[model samples]
Target chain A: MSARHHPADAVLADYAAGTLRPGFDIVVAAHVESCERCRRHVRLFEKAAGAMMSDLPPAEMSADALPLMLARLERNPPAASADAPIAPPRDTRSLIERLPVKRRRWLAPGVWVQPIDVPQLPGDKLYFLRVAAGIRGLHHGHSGPEFTAVVSGALRDGKTTYRAGDFIECDTEVVHRPKVLAQDGGCLCIAASEGSLKGQGFLGELIRTIAGV
Target chain B: MTPEPSIETSEPARELAPEDLIVAIAVRADRDAFARLFQLFAPRLKSYLIGLGTTPPAAEELAQEAMLSVWRKAAFFNRSRAGASTWIFTIARNLRIDAARKERSALAYAVDLSEEPDAPEQPDAIVSGAERDLKVREALKSLTPDQVTVVRMSFFQEKPHSEIAADLGIPLGTVKSRVRLAMARLRERLEELL
Candidate 1:
């Protein structure tokens, strides 16, 4: 899709300052993933943020913080913790699985999710997924700018394959098929649709309806 | 640990377009580069956050979190569209919006998702008669106190409307009109600055 600019200045300024609500932040992030102009402005903000972070009083770890952490490590034992006795590592799960899930706003069998590491946001839809590989999900349009970063595994759009930790931004102008490329682990992704998703046609609408999303 | 002065003070600190390169070094687990990134952004981020109605501690938390994200996700940096700082800046911006939105009502004044951007219609650069940053500053100074408050508060709010109400303890409708008036005045002020 053709790229869109970043959110307007007031919003951009707030975003740069790190004062926006987490939900709104998610929407802008998803949009930033796709829009370069917004990214450029955001870069300026990040530079400013870095400079500011340096100015803050040094962040000291809690007194005895290291020992407390170490004591926990010793009690659990590194070997035992590695063994995954209590919470079995869904080897099928990605590292994102270990993090807290964003509250799922839209959930279904084919898709459900919980936010992870995101602060808070609004008008942004967070989706979790259990995709069957090779399923050709409908090609879709971004109603506005959208950002999707991979919390785990990956999904493919046309020629690009988004792996775990990858950041993908799509604007309302994009039209592409997002197909899952089965990783060693099943793919798990965190997607924030900034505004809304414009289903390509009846087919896309059909998929959304079936999933009740 | 900070490197010795002999260690080159991180990422060469020279290249005119070191943005992507800065991101690359940061991705390599280089704390010094990360420090440079922090030096580049945190203040503006803080100013922006303060605009949102967040307490100082909350704003600082956003800064730390955004920076940590740079540390963890620097490797994902892509240069085709923007520089490293911009990419990270956008992340911080998005996170800030998220932080303010949790307990608030839906983002009423936020971007209308249904609307699509005109296919990259290049905004004619607002002519900065002075230097680029200077023009922004000049425009800021030109605004009335009310306008400035609106702009500053704009920087703070997730939705922008209610924060004005809460900040000023006025009604929501009053906040909306004032914001509109301030924005209109700002656009005019910017024209002179440009």
Candidate 2:
């Protein structure tokens, strides 16, 4: 989408090593909410990390450390959260659910051009367009590396059509004109833009503010 | 290992041994359980900060701060979502933001250890506090170089794009792309392992 793209390798390593931040992790979580490409990437990294952990020699903790940790067990201690099935918040789920999960190139109604959901986010910038059917999306505009995915349906931007599971990246040099192409009612889309929209006209701004874009 | 003696009826000590118990005590607001939690997490917090590139003093202080949060916010831990190591990592990861915010220039906290020549860098010692953390370096090495850098950048500073740009000397957009790609890749990798 941009002059460059996020390397799949780096994300795998970071998540594997548990070095990523929560906010950033949330962004990635949002993307995983819609996109499978990024999901696959995360899965791969997890595997690699597990292998590494399995291979490394165990660190010898102080004798007291284990006892200390155990001694506290008799009391009611804090319970930590697991990383399994980390579901989206109710607001996000409700918004995404109303729209179809798997559409054939559907676009939200608005001025936004790219029609895709499932953004691999938390990088620098991410964009999401929550438009309804028959709504003219944002006019042709370019921003930083913009990755779009459909949380619901599909869309057609010029020749390159996008589907529910597809991932789209439109970088600084690329501007898109996206239109919804779903037959079963409509779709919901979630996109991540590297930077704010560029070259958006007055109409774009007006619509964006109106739609809370 | 002589599994820790069952709870002493006198003290509602339900914490310790398989970390689940630790959580149980933590839920009860047991101070001793909290101390145990502190003992377990304090060192990892320190190393994670070090990995992000904090000074020893700063890392120690930050680690202590994170432990205190565990003590205070123990109720928030959802064991069903993560186990001990991973959940603690999440806590430290969340707190890392606060640490980075303290210094405007901190991009995330990638401690090269070697970068700070004057500081006695104990790359292994710092990380060894948590056995799982000790494995992180190797796991990271298993990823592609591009993925590695972006993920590392995420940990180095609290500031999202701007600081990442400065620290890596790349454009803001590039950093974002890298993170997107990295998360996807990591998610995929972890899934395979599971």
For model 1 chain A, give the 10-residue run with minimal summed lDDT: A73-82
Model 1, A42-67: lDDT tens digits are 44433333333333344333355334
Query: How much is the TM-score of the A chain of model 1?
Result: 0.51
Q: Which lDDT values do the candidates have, in the order given? A: 0.50, 0.48
Clashes of each: 62, 107
Among these predicted structures, which one has the highest TM-score? 2
Question: Tens digit of lDDT per residue, candidate 1, span B15-134?
Answer: 323353344443344444545555555555554565445666676667666666555555545443333444555566656645654522123112321122322434543221113344
Q: What is the lDDT for B187 in model 1?
A: 50
For lDDT, the strongest prediction is: 1
Question: Which 10-residue window of candidate 2 chain A scores lowest in summed lDDT?
Answer: A1-10
Off by over 4 Å in 1: A1-213, B1-30, B43-61, B72-88, B97-132, B158-174, B185-194
